[model samples]
Target: MADGSLARMGPEHREEAWQRLGSDTFDLVVIGGGVVGAGTALDAATRGLRVALVEARDLASGTSSRSSKLFHGGLRYLEQLEFSLVREALRERELMLTKIAPHLVKPVSFLYPLTHRFWERPYTAAGLLLYDTMGGARSVPGQKHLTRAGALRMVPALKRDALIGAIRYYDAQADDARHTLTVARTAAHYGAVVRTSTQVVDFLREADRVSGVRVRDVEDGRETEVNAQAVINCTGVWTDELQRLSGSRGRFRVRASKGVHIVVPRDRIVAETGLILRTEKSVLFVIPWRNHWIVGTTDTDWNLDLAHPAATRSDIDYLLEHVNQVLATPLTHDDIEGVYAGLRPLLAGESEETSKLSREHAVARVAPGLVAIAGGKYTTYRVMAADAVDAAAVDLSGRLQPSITDRVPLLGADGYYALVNQTDQLASRYGLHPYRVRHLLDRYGSLVHDVLAMAEGRPELLRPLPAAPDYLRVEVVYAASHEGALHLEDVLTRRTRISIEYPHRGVDCAEAAARLMGEVLGWDDATIAHEVEVYQARVQAERESQDQPDDQAADASRAAAPEARPNVSEPVR
Candidate 1:
């Protein structure tokens, strides 16, 4: 293989991996393809270990893709006295912005509105002072206190009476799905056998020790037994279920907390900086996104569906009501372009409320050769991965290296700043706008050349999708050929985020995107038609589900749609 060349997760890669299944024993096998799991694979592989990561579905198809998209110390957690957690997260955030994945994660400013006239400014300022200084929180601006007039100037969408003052602080934001996918690709680049669309049917056991896994390829129903010395479980919300499959009672239980978010057009909220407001239970965020603003997040216990968390009409109404308390122009359901719900794997505690559960993660040697990790925020995924691999190292034979992932930049991270300086020149070289070239540089960094090279002979690939002008035709093809996008949902939902950004929820561009993906994946006319139909049905189902009044009804409405891959199913406990 080319040294450090791109690990193309195309059709050819999957076939070659399928043929090599169980060919040789691995040092460690990782279960789950979410952020932590992908991070664990990279950590182990970079330490010169033979690693294999198996995901039940596509990478970041779970909670990893559905975060608030911030890499910050939980500001509210300070109120709860989670100082250590906050400090650790801030260090990780600084690492992401400066050293690790600078291309994907960048600084974002948030305005925390103050309601009370007295005692609020100093109290809030002191907390923020600690937040900025703790754990060497560098790479972002320190907290800035703003007057009521200044706050309103920053965000005219906010009502004049909404705040007495405000404090603007910087935190890093990332496309969560893209970051997770890049982590998986980085692991594969380091010689880790990263395979998606594969499910662990059962744990291979020798006496009381866990040996390996019995995995089935979800594409064609073929099964294989892969041998490994150690197995690390990073299956976030599904941690309990997988531990049960291992015939071991988990040391800690993972309770699912459902958080729902709604995407509205950027013009709806006239804000230079994102807004953060206090709620009855937790804080509400109006996060700035490209051409859109993500306002979300209702937290409640989720027991209905882990695979597909549906946002009910009540969830939407709750968000609208809380946000409208401060908005000059209230947002209605009609203004919402997209809605999504994700489950956070919280460690079970004495509190009945999911919000009160601990964000701290725990690692347990669940069995002789199995190590399980669960319950941490998305911002601390690297630390969580290091802990999981550190636990797994006990079962490994050779001299293992400590996690050097803190020093290793992600796939598109290296030389990103240099390329950003040449955005104007790059735009001139390619037949594209300067704005478009800058956008590409931010998303792909140094890898923009590789994506642009695909359009070398075929200039048509450089053009944007007719329905979805924000993304190009080559991006769809690249998602299938380079990013591990095996289905249309993979491309639309996670790879490019067309599903959440588009007003039509990717339905308008479904056929076109499927057609582009089919060209790279070698799909027949029938396969292309089927993919389009499935995506359309999914969009229809999501729309219907969002209209439902409660989670039960919403879950039922959403579950009516069929999965993109027929054989892909959640692992049984």
Candidate 2:
């Protein structure tokens, strides 16, 4: 089948989905459009089951979009003695790198700095040795020992006295938001009915079993009852709330652990390889992103708002203080381009510390027709999805085939490698610079042609946005027409990542992007102006919230701004 036919997911696709939601009974109805939910939809649909997926907001609007963007086996988990989790995650990482999403997931190298002399090198080396061979990490380079001079040469940003030596190893990374969206689109390609901006208000019960769901359209307030043989809940941080709606005493509890990451320009830190530093509570990562660096993550319990986890001044200071210890030139708040906070749905354990909670996921057959899976990291989303669908299989009629998602390439993965080889030719054909064409290939793969095709009649679309030159004008239009981007925030924040990558946090580009998206989404001047205004308010709120002292103050600061989609209510506590 042609790739374009794989469920357009644009405005028209969303309109058609409303008609189908109540028309037919599905074999499985999956709630949540995060990575695991999208993966579950793909897994069930691939097994020849009639499937449907519903998300309360846009795809990857929650934890899925706000990840650290690593596809690594938890190296820290190895020290925790959770070898099974590490091994499973490593296998999944390899699957994404080599088989599942070669277009999206790519290998990345990290330098583990050593402070002590004799014991540190050998100890870290031994652990890395096990990590390399555990799940066939042959696709990436193995560990290499480096002296202080060598390490400094690799990362000139590090303090000369910070590390006695270092060990460099390899892992993988991807655009988490894009990857999650691709999974949902790929599921649609395989005949699953997927709709976003649709929320499950309550569970449909047959006796004591959950038979389906009563869904409400967050956009127009339209309501529908979707009947299904079984329902799989993949709501990550919202797992407990969803469980309560099912009226089931869930098998496990989900604890919210908030993690915050700060983004700075790549020129701020002179590093060829990413850095992994050991902290008292947990390990910290200085991951390399395109033209920028992502320094992150404080593991603290989050009891406040779940939908918008605000990053406070203390949260930013905690990350800056820990990461600053190793830097030759310390990063100040002025140097930061963006700050984001995300909640990790950790499975509750005996330990009082949220950091000590389990990253391993648990799947349970909560009621007769309900299955809930929660508490896994991003790298193993496919495995978690497979397990969720497998639990739901008991209610399925016939003997279903095992998962074939391992063999099914996402929509753009098929001709990506070949297209990479033909970059110069593609550039020549499209009348774009070679570098620009290469960038499009990495982001869109074979779908780059579809995006560039939108610029054929209107040559102005090929030009870059005045404020955000890294992204072309056509991208904003294509995002609305093809990628299911419903608002200005969707394009700036996720579709192209202009929000986090820019200095003004997308304020300067908001009007231009809104205008571009308006042409495709058929928005009037008033609608475009409102979109631009809302985006500006969001950025202003985030900036003010980041300056606040604690979570409460930050949450209030953030809450002052109106949501782009107005009906997006607070998470049910």
Candidate 3:
């Protein structure tokens, strides 16, 4: 691995990456830029292998950005008697909290209310006890039993009759998109050629075995061949499609399960800790976001569009109905700030229900030089990546090194705690509030200086955005300049999350953000205006789709919006 390689992913860097992709024959080429894909690239690159990571869209543009944003062992999985999966996930959570990404991953407490008169507390406590001890390393506190009054005191928004008792447990949470992007950047730092808006059109073959891939630049329709010894398919929901494109029969099938989530104002839910409620189908979580509460998620089969999964009116109503059961004041449609839907790539089983499908990942050598991995939780992405690289080792000729990513911290993780201790000094130096400095540190860690450095001469860039005051104007510039944001949606939705956290859903700041991005990307006036119009249309389409009654209608409405990446097309069948 190249020590201290440049991690900047700006436009100039992207051009270099494209040139490298066309000329170099890599040891491994990882497809998909989601968390697992990014993790796979990091794993391969750190092993001193020549690696290249290509994505059709921006990093975490799909399911990775739309997760529940937690790094916990699945409590429900414990009930399902999947102790191994839960234990593995818990170990990964501990790694993320203490070793991997302390800046991005943080401890979050959740209250599980009890409705039954007896047996519920002990039954739940037994599970929590196992959960706390399974990981071997203890970072967060264990579960605490509480009476209904104590629970109500902890969560004043809960109704008096909602729970007889409660059990509060600790878990870790982070911005999934930012975390994924950091993994990709860390891979790039280790000499991995990372490029987005580059789509794989077909598999390149030598004799009967898979050799490499033919990729197209989605922005301009330029095609090139990326030769590699082995290619790993890490596409989550699109796993099956890519496998089919390779002309290889996948050993396992990936089924798409739609999970919908709604974002509401934090004040609407008066809770010190997040809430986890029991639903008829699965568990419901009211997760605590920065200034909002994220409540979701219904597990239903989805066979429609994979790129943009639409959340129908029924899906939103389902979440509101379940969450309102425990809230003192019921939430209505008007209370919602934003809505998003993502598809889970589940390993298909005999059971028809998507919830019943396995959460454990499966890796198989689909072809001589091609490996496919799918059906795993976000917490266990590193493990999945390591396993995938291990499977690809057969295709590689030389003696390969073992995975050392567990010991390797992400790019910004170093000196984060020290930075937190010096927040006041940092705020003073930057001429900003300590709170804003703290926010920047959490998002950028030691690299916060890299972000602040962009405003050396441009002082106005440090100021807060007019429409979304929570995010600074400099963040929009940083997204385009360093975060591999090829389009305006990549900035608003994944890089800054202005698309979901605010009431206007980033519409009010579209023009401002587009112009800021244009300055870095060298967009003309017409290009800036087109970007704003496209982003606004996307927001409007999402709103319209959310109002639709069913998935079919919702998919049609959402698909009507123009794609930001003009040349992106479906995979070749």
| lDDT top scorer | 3
- lDDT tens digits by residue: candidate 3, 1-573: 212238889999999999999999999999999999999999999999999999999999999999999998999999999999999999999988988899999999999999998688889888889888896239888889999999999999999999999999999899999999999999999889999999999999999788899999998889999999999999999999999999999999999999999999999999999999999999999999999999989999999989999999999999999999989999999999989899999999999999999999999999999999999999999999999999999999799999999998887898899999999999999899999999998898888888898899999999998799999999998889988998999999999889989889999999999999999999999999999999999999999999999999999999999999978887643
Can you tell me which runs of candidate 1 are displaced by over 4 Å?
A: 1-4, 135-137
Per-residue lDDT of 1-573 in model 2, one digit per residue for the tens? 128456578888888888898998899999999999999999999999999999998899999999899999999898999999999999988888887888899999999999998998989888998999897367898899999999999999999999999999999999999999889989998899999889999899888778899999888899999999999999998999999887888999999999999999999999999999999999999999989999988899888878889999999999999999999999998999989999999999999899899899999999899999999999999999999999988887889789988888887888888899999999888888999987887777788888898899899999998788888999888889888889898899888888888898899989889998998888999999999999999999999999999988999999888888898665457
Q: What local lDDT score does residue 152 receive in model 3, on the 0 to 100 scale?
A: 95
Q: How close is every model to the real structure, measured as TM-score?
A: 0.98, 0.98, 0.99
Name model 2 segments beyond 4 Å from true: none
Q: How well does candidate 1 score on lDDT at residue 391?
A: 93
lDDT of 1 by residue, 1-573 (tens): 122245788899888777666787998999999999999999999999999999989999999999999998988899999999999999899899998888899889999999887899999998998898895347778999999999999999999999988999988899999999989999998889889999998999999999999999988899999899999999999999899888987899999999999999999999999988889898899999988999988899998878889999999999999999999999998999999999999999999988889999999998889999999999999999999989987899978898899998988888888888888889899889989987776777777887888899999999998788988898888889888899999999999888999888898988888889999999999999999899999999999999999999999999999998778766564
Descending-lDDT candidate ranking? 3, 2, 1
